[model samples]
Target: MQKRILLSLIVLLGACSTEKPDTVSIESQDDMKHASSVAANSTENREEVSLSLLEKSDSKYSYKLNGMKFSSNDRVLKKGSVVQSLSESGSGLIKGSFVVIASQLPKGVIEHYEVNEIATSTYRLIPLEIGGDLYELYQALRQNDVFSRVEIEIDYSGKQTSDSF
Candidate 1:
């Protein structure tokens, strides 16, 4: 009786297994080809822009790259200049420190920075201090050649206030 039961279980498991040929639908193949073509065209259209590093200064730093002001350090940046340092309040709905997300995990990140693994690609960076200097930290991360891309987190809450209009 036990042998019969075992045979029945084996048959049920075998029936449940799904082993089929690795075949994709025609529509899926066409979609993949279209995506590759679009990617190639977009890459051909992209133009490279370069940024030059300025002299090292202790009393903050500022520069205009492609007409965009990059202000760094604790010093109060000029009006309309892009502030590189982490800000508590300025323009965004949730104005806070700069959050750095890399395409790949970077090495030797500052001890103060906390790394939260959202997924294989996504990571959330949080500092112990709200006023931590993230711009400097970002520059340090950029120097490492291992990371593909590192950028600040932009707030896109889509909350419309009176000032927006």
Candidate 2:
């Protein structure tokens, strides 16, 4: 048993020799900190956004702006920044974000609506329009249903899935 234990110790000592390999070290061991700092600075120019609605429009007011937010308490109000409809801008991945509400309605049309966030500068590129199906939207407005479901894409921090069943 003693001989067996000695043999195992000899094998273990042989495996863990202090000899260093001749492989190349790109930088000295302590230089990794400098490399990480350079990398961090290269991609750290992100802008922080405060969550605030900048604009809102519907059929009622003709592009009036006083920088006011919407409220349910007011029965007769005008020109609030709440972006009631969805606006489309950009191509491909950025297409689903940004929206313009009620900018497409005919002359002198007035309604109520909300606005969404300014997630990207892409919103500026999209032509403003009331977001919905053209035919059904016309029917609903004629039928006197003043409000419609507004669709807007936000930065939903979750796994996205296809709508196909």
Which residue segments of model 1 deviate by more than 4 Å? 1-107, 156-165
lDDT (C-alpha, whole model) for all candidates:
0.50, 0.33
What's the count of clashing pairs in each model shown? 0, 13
TM-score for each predicted model, relative to the true structure: 0.35, 0.20
lDDT of 2 at 32: 79
Tens-digit per-residue lDDT, 28-140, candidate 2: 75677777776776645221121122133223322111122212222322112222212222111112222333334333232232233344311211223534322233333
lDDT of 1 by residue, 1-165 (tens): 999999999999998878985874546877989888988877765522112222334455653322234445534322222344233333322233334446766554546566777667656565545444555555655566765545555344444342331
What is the Cα-based lDDT of residue 10 in candidate 2?
A: 100
Candidate 2's C-alpha runs over 4 A off are: 22-123, 127-165
Using lDDT as the measure, the top candidate is 1
